[model samples]
Target: MTRRTVRIAMNGVTGRMGYRQHLVRSILAIREQGGLDLGDGEVVWPEPVLVGRRAHALEELAERHGLTEWSTDLDAVLADDSVEIYFDAQVTSARVEAIKKAIAAGKHVYTEKPTATDVEGALDLARLARDAGIKHGVVQDKIFLPGLRKLKRLIDGGFFGEILSVRGEFGYWVFEGDWQAAQRPSWNYRAEDGGGIVVDMFPHWEYVLHELFGQVTSVTAHVRTHVPQRWDEQGKPYEATADDAAYGIFELAGGAVAQINSSWTVRVNRDELVEFQVDGTHGSAVAGLRNCRVQHRSSTPKPVWNPDLPVTESFRDQWQEIPDNQEFDNGFKAQWELFLRHVVQGAPYTWDLLAGARGVQLAELGLKSSAEGRRFDIPELTL
Candidate 1:
């Protein structure tokens, strides 16, 4: 009996998500968990070689992780036969070229979302991976979230007899890299860098909607640039070339409607960083990052709108909390484990390049809708 160890070359290993999500949380941490029990002792441990742009930064990160293999040359790493997988966490603008190079080098790939900034580019990469006969996957971590997973179970169990609509509210005030260091990368504020709330996040909603409810058939969107300028890491001003907020209406395949409001300018008002409310004919469920609550018609409360009346008690007690049944790890980390299993043990992983293309398609359609001031029909992604 032999154990298979997958050697991974991590591109953009020093970036925010690259460091936190892929490296520390996913590969190193999961490896510590003895490679995410895939049954039958067919464990997978990542023999990772960190690839970055700066030798100093790469070496520092390697030392932090007690790893010695770090490189500044991506092409050199790809040319190495021992690198069976090329994982990308590069900026969205850089992902396409890196993934293409990895595919050309005959290595399996796992990459961060938007796979490419545009639908055609994403489709091309998907086709390239298919033509090359290499395994490829994208990160769709939100679907694997524990709270969302439970909500999915409820939906699957008919708790929502017929889902009428889904409302998603996701946002937080991203720091203006000037006065307060921006929580997100500077590129996220630049259009050329593939940064924009709509482009970056709609794919997440698209997949979640498709996976939990149904496929999106059409989209009507309104995008806005709330703050025209934001500061970079050095407290220098940079004109924001991308939109900060987007509101979209999606018509799903089953006639279910979904509304998504994604922004970088809103303040958090709830327990979860991201919250969703699914309303059905029989009941309604509200799910956040930390908790889920349900309200049935039988237990529903009536409400009246009044300007002078106290509003605290109307809907406060209408829903009951769903008990937390499982410990939820970081969403990115969980997806990483799954990808490893999918690669090593052939586990059912549907977040492939095609799925990524679907997300890009929706984003493309959203952009079209926003630009033309008309609803756009989304054609299905043909693998």
Candidate 2:
């Protein structure tokens, strides 16, 4: 077997998502599995060069993971001829410039989304990557999740005669850093720092709804900063300049409506941190991060509207659980594998920089809709 190494310059491994999901779960896990097999006597191994702002953190992470290469100077790492790919999990504000540098260096690029703070920036990146002839992609991990995969199966099998609507609830109470340490970084609450629920989660909703359902033709949103004063990582009080919650309604191309609520102030009473209930003419399904349940119209029980009487029906028990018929890998890791295959084998991959630009465009439009108190029609994007 021919074993080939593809060196990847991974920027911003010190962050939470960067460290836990991208580095440990995805890249490192792939390495542990003895590289990805491209078949035909060829195997592609990932050689990650940790790149970040803090030398100590990068060094510590590299040492902890038994990785040999670590560099604080991104320029130096990018200059390395062996580094074939550049992956970014940096803060949203820092991502654009870093990715630009990577593309200019003639490296294939992949990164976490919203690819840029605004639509124009995201489109610029897409154009740059296309013109440079470098393959690029964005992390659309949700589509690979087990629960959503089940939902997709149902959709493909024509279980839903006519999909009508989708409702999504995502979020948990992020503790004020004063009483308990905030689970999210402090920058997530600052607008100037490119932090907000709309900026953070709308891109996710856009991709999820678009991929599984239809194109988002229009959007109407209401956004708010539910928690005004919160403490930072340093335990210092700071005004939360960004909206922590967003209520949005997206109109899909095929007339399906998606209503999603993203909030950091809400308490979880559901099965998962995030869940989507999709209702159709023939059936309905509720999918969370790991579980999916469905109910067919034929099996649905009819209950009389009795506001004056106590409810006796077990509403939750009516749904049937979808069995996991096959083994499921971590969503992030699965996408990573796909991206790696696309890079190594010249496989057809649709989730490119242009797809990433659409996500950013959705987020940007969501914010605009909220601010102007009106719905905005989405414009088609091209690179």
Candidate 3:
């Protein structure tokens, strides 16, 4: 068997998502598994070169993981001819310039979203990547989640016959950084720092809605800053300039409507932090991060509502659980494997920079809809 080593420059390893999910769970996990087996007696091995702003943190992380390559100088790393791919998990404000440099360096690129802070910047990145003739992708991890995958399976098997509508609830309380330090970085609540619920999450909704149900045709949103003030990492107070919550109604192409409520101020009451309830003519399903329960038309219980009497039926008990027929891997790891195959073996990868741009477009339109207090039609995007 022949083994091919692909060198990837992974920037932003010092950050939260960068350190935990991408670096540890995804890339290193692949290496621990003895590389990805491509069948046909070929194995693709990944070599990650950690890049970040903090030299100390990078050094420490490299030492802990026994990874040799670590760099604070992005230019020097990009200059290396051996580095075939550049991955970015940097702050939203810094992603564009770095990716632009990577494209100029003629390296394949992968990044977290919003690929840019705005639609124009996102589209520019797409155009540049296309012109550079480099393979590129953005993280759309939600689609790979077990619950969503099973939901997709049901949809494919025509379980939800003539899909009607979808309702999604996603969020939990984020500490205000006073008595308890905020779970999220203080920058997430600041508009100047490319933070806000709309910017942070609407991209995810765009892809999830598009992939599972249909293309989003229109959006109407109510955006708010529920927590007006919050403390920073240093325990200092600052005005929260960004919207903390957003209630949105998205109209899909197939006449199906989706209402998703995203908030950082709300308390959790559902079985999962994020859940989607999809209703159709034949069956209905409630899918969370790891579990999915369904109630079909034939076996669905009929409940009678009366103000005079207390409820007797357990509504939750009416649904049946979907069994996991196969093992599931981390969503981030799954996508990384796919991107590796796409890079080395010329495999088909449809989620490109253009698709990421479309997501940015959705967030932009959503914010505009909230500001204008009217619904906006989602225009088709092009390279």
Candidate 4:
């Protein structure tokens, strides 16, 4: 068989995540390191053509990455016979339309999450890709985190036997753009652009829950917009029409329960942006972004809470640090490498469009549950 190098046409390359996460961290750094090692006869490296709206910005990015090809026209890139794959890191609202066009143009697609703003649109895109006989995938990077991977290993090894409940606390204080310049895009605060915590993050939790415990059978959630207004990059204050925080209770398929608190207002007092505490009949595990601690039934604590007395110690003394056994890689880079292997070597990539659609389905359910003030059952995707 001839060795094939995948040529990628990257749309939204000038955006925040496009430039920082996908382009710089995943593509350029991986290319500089001589491509990703598939651990066999196969290897994959992306040869990307930057596509964006601004010529100067595109040209500068191309020069910085040593890429000779840059185009202001997305249609022209899609028309090029040399480009076999189209990658999209555009905003959530624009992703579906661009992906549809790419599929229509006979190009494989790898796009960012929340593949579409709603379940119908996401499912439609998946169906289109299947009909077109094109490979399609969405970015599910949370499962690749070292901490989460370690948690998965423990669960697989029965460290958490007969898991009862799981708790996830995720947050960071997003700058108001006026004072410190927002770390995320301004569009993320606008509902018109499909910007909201529920849509943006439920996909991540869906996969994480599926990977660690079991699939979510139902969800009851309450979402709120903590800050009513926020400034954009230009210091223009805009009405925040999206939810900045969401509190959700998930019922797992196996009778286990899980709670997730996702927010943009909390200050990080811990070691990472996200952390999980899983409790089981036999043991429990606490996992952060880079480390994990386990406490068996033998070491389980018995304590009583009292505001007048000293705080009771939980499993602090029994906390064992998880050692680093592999090289550190960004979550996005790991997912990108896996996608490349899936394309080049026929490796199994579970983060398909169906999985992405499932995420949107959950988010939609969450919204409905919040609106109705009741728990909602998640419907299975027919596709």
**Each prediction's TM-score against the native?**
0.96, 0.99, 0.99, 0.95
Per-residue accuracy of model 1 over 1-383 as CA lDDT, tens digit each: 24677899999879987898788988898778776676786677688999988999999998887997989899999999989999998888888998999999999999989898889999999999999998889989888777798898798889989899999999999987777788998889899888999888999999999999999999999999999999887788999999999999999999999998999999989778899999998999999876789998888887777989677784757789988777788888888777877777777888899999999999989988999999999887796
Per-prediction backbone clash count: 0, 0, 0, 0
Give lDDT tens digits, candidate 4, residues 224-301. 999999999889999999999999999999999999999998899877899999999889888988888888888666
Q: Estimate the TM-score for candidate 4.
A: 0.95
**Model 3, stretches more than 4 Å misplaced?**
none
Q: In candidate 3, how many Å is residue 333 off?
A: 0.3
What lDDT would each prediction earn against the true structure? 0.89, 0.94, 0.95, 0.88
Structure candidate 1, residue pairs in collision: none
User: Candidate 2: which stretches are off by over 4 Å?
Assistant: none
Worst 10 residues of 1 by lDDT: 35-44
The digit string of per-residue lDDT tens for model 2 on 1-383 reads 99999999999889999999999999999999998888779888999999998999988898898999999899999999899999999999999999999999999999999899999999999999999999999999999999999999999999988999999999999999998999999999999999999989998988899899999999999999999999998999999999999999999999999999999999999999999999999999999998999999999899899899999889999999999999999999999889999989889899999999998999999999988999999999986
- State how far residue 97 of model 3 sits from its true place (Å): 0.2
Clash number for model 3?
0
Query: What's the C-alpha lDDT at position 1 in model 2?
Result: 94
Q: Quick one: best lDDT, which candidate?
A: 3
**Candidate 3 TM-score versus the reference:** 0.99
